[model samples]
Target: MNSIGNIKPFLQKVIRSGVGRWRFFAATLGLLVALVIILLSLQLYLNFNQLLHGKANESETAEFLVISKEVTAENQSKKNESYFLPEEIALLGKQPFADRVGEISSTNFIVTISSFSNAFPFYTDAYFESVPDEFIDIKTEDWSWKQGQVNIPVIIPSFFLELYNTGMAMSQENLPRLSLEALQAIPLRVNIKHSGGTAEFVAHVAGTTDRLNSVLVPEAFMQYANKAYGYQESKPPTRLVLKTLDAADPALQSFLVANSYTTNSDKTKLNKARIIVNWIAGVVGIIGLIMLLFGMLVFTLFIQLTIAASRMDIVLLQTLGASPRQLSGYLMGMFMPVYGAMVMIALLVLSVLQYGIHQLLLQKQLLVSPWLSVYTLAAAALWLLLIWFVNKRTITNYLKAG
Candidate 1:
């Protein structure tokens, strides 16, 4: 405390001069450079992890494992040969790597789709399927179904939408191409027919998924419809959706091969995308490290020059009975604010940048996760410690020579 008081007057006079403060401000620039790199590094790390462990059904990281019985002569003898036997499904459940396995329950009745608020413009024969909600990636408040509610919510495959727009809509001039936004706006009607009669329900498009190649209804709704309209009450599902811990898990492929199961989508493509993302992130990280190294070098050189410029003042203070500890404390007080200011400035800039990025990603229906604030704070603290260490060492060495 006394050391701060001793140097207050001199510090105030020196700080008032623009020329004298130039060196300090220049030192802050190095600090700023270092901070920028660290901020970018944190961002790169977050993006890498998001892509690496992204959802199985997301566009950024598409992961769908649809397993069905392999096409074989022996199995083709039966009408519905792809069905997994009860014991076979039980054995699959025992594997440690399989996250969750759900049956793809098909509607045992017929479904007819039509549009309201417009003429009966198009017609298509469609079947509905459902799985447990846990296997679904796109979560929405509207993606739900109850027994009494007439309106049914459903998810459609992305490729089917593309096919409709490109193949059917393009060829027929009278047919209108439907965009996701447009489809959600106009209401739809779904007719579920049973042996007894037909029931019409209002329908809407909740969302779209790249994984499931079928129109999906809620699990509860599927169960209700099947019970009401199904010819066979105790029939087993022919297709299954397996949610695994990882796409690259060796055990998954080995087990699939052993059971002669076939996949609807290629898992190898996802593995390749992950590899490409890793390479890009690694390159970004290396560039940040290089910038940080340059920052350290600039910081050291600036401190040495500043110390040499003020050598005479340090000597005179020593002659006036100011101990080395007092001089060191005084130096720390003078520079600590600059160090602290740099950190504050850097954080402010990064915060604004992060927020801007978050907004931009949101517009595209994408997500950008924030970095860990505590981790960045720890890094900044270490940087401050480095500045303090250098300041003390330079002062102690100069004082020893006197």
Candidate 2:
């Protein structure tokens, strides 16, 4: 440390006399800009990945899609075409995009739900649908049923409550607006009518879901009721619920269109937007890489120029017993601090930008971390090492030639 400290000033004077200060500064500025662009592009790519695939951005039910046959004019009158055949279900399950496919089972018996209280007097014929318990978003202990259980739990669509509150209650003189809590508190009489007779069960809203647009019941209850009350043979499902990692995959959309199937458009609407953003990110990253290569080349050329101009001085110093290793070490020590400072400045700028982006995305209900991703940090370190290697090689090669 003492030797390095004593020799540093003399080496600085010799190198400074040889290299133009303005040229060195220009090369450094270019390197800094290139580094910043590379880091920014990496950070942006990571941010988009978090928004698209991060756990914080995933809803419990977002990966599930309820698919059904498209109701076209030609197929509207054909009852058989409306239901998916056994071969069709098997083929759909074999699709690469579908992790698993479960049929949406409809009630085989007629169902009627009526308000139990006189204050909210209402009676309407209703349909019940059931899917596997894992697919249901509402997690509750009450979402279970067995034989002889008088109380039944049901999950309704969130829009049903919203429509009643906004449209129905506003127009009706006596009907009061019901919140989710209030709706869950009220009991309704569920009547199962079949060829045998009528059976009544007390039912209450266990929860509401925004994922599925239908009234839901426990799979156990639906299977039992369908077996006991259904007068005809069981029919194939008209709809299917599919589990997938990416609902916005274009291949999934193309398959659906080719097969004349349809699903909730809201779930797959991000397809185009995601594709466009990915393309833009890719292009930006390529541009940054090109800039980084150019910056590295400029730094190499600058080091070569400095060594060439100071060849006589370097040879005299060697004759005076300054080792080649010492000279190389001094050159490295001189430039490494500046390179480190550039990296720090780039990271600082990215951190601030990332924090601002996180806040902005949070307002729109999208999730992203305020900190830089590990991949981005690793990339920065890798680039720094690459620059070091290039600079070291250039310095050693030029000094040997001198």
Candidate 3:
């Protein structure tokens, strides 16, 4: 070990004397550029994912979309054509983009809501819709109901309040604007009219949701009321609430268009942006991989050139009792540090860019980590290992041949 240690510096000096400075510098620069580009592509992908799927960016309403058949002139008069058949719902559920599919049940009976307080007097004919409890964004204890319940809980769309405040309240002299808290405090008189008679139930706003744009009621209450007061037989669902993994998936948009289904455009507007980003990232990654191959090839040529130039010196050293393993180890020790340094420099540059991007995106209300992603770090380590393997193999083979 001591003899080998003593010979390392001499072997390193002999090996490096034959290396062309210009070629080594160019090879190092190319390798650094390749690593940076590869890491940059990976970081871009992760940052986009963070913006879309991070906990800080996640919305309870983002995963749910209320979809319905498009009301075209041809299908408007045909009630059956507007409804989703059981097979259609099953097929939608089986789709890769849809995590789960739920039917949006609507009341079959006449319904009306009026303010109980004369001071805030307003009356309107309304309809009630219900979806499964899991799909509802608003969670409240009052959302459940049983038979003979005197009071019914209701959930309204947040935009409904906005529309009333901006449109109706501005137009009417007697109507006053209501805040969400005030709206929840007001009690409503719900009148369920059937062919037999009208039944009254006191209803109160339990919550408001940005997800579903409908007057929502407990599914249990909707089922019971539709049975007890329904003038017509229950029909298939005309609307569906879908739970999806990605609201902006392009395949989801394609499927909707193919089946004449329509959903909220605002929720899916990012589909094009996502596709564009993916294409850009893919192109960058491919370019980086090509450059990396060229870089590795150049590095291998540099090594081969140095070994060929030092062939006479290496033969003399081996004849003077130095082992091929010792020379190979010394050559590796010289080159591996440079490779490690290049990787570190690439990571540092990426971290700075990521932090800058994180701050920039924060201004636009997008959230991403300032540090590098685990996948990026893993990729760096993997590439470093590959470089080491390639360098080691080249040194061992050249030393044996010499």
- Which of 1 and 3 is the better model by lDDT? 3
> Per-residue alpha-carbon lDDT of model 2 for 198-240, expressed as tens digits?
9999999999997678899999998998999887777899989
Better of 1 and 2 by lDDT: 2
Q: Assess the local accuracy of residue 252 in candidate 2 as a C-alpha lDDT between 0 and 100.
A: 86
TM-scores for all candidates: the values are: 0.52, 0.77, 0.89
Order of the predicted models by TM-score, top scorer first = 3, 2, 1
Candidate that scores best on lDDT = 3
- Give the Cα error of residue 360 in candidate 1, in Å: 28
Backbone clashes, candidate 2: 0
Model 1, span 75-193: residue lDDT tens: 78885677888787777778775776888889888889886755536556788999898788778998888889998888988887789899988998877898998877767778878
Model 3 steric clash pairs: none
Looking at model 1, which ten-residue stretch has the lowest summed lDDT?
11-20
Candidate 3, run of 10 with poorest lDDT: 53-62
- Model 3 residue 219 CA deviation (Å) reads 0.6
**Which digits, one per residue and each the tens of the lDDT, describe model 3 over residues 236-280?**
999999988788888999999999999974668788888899899
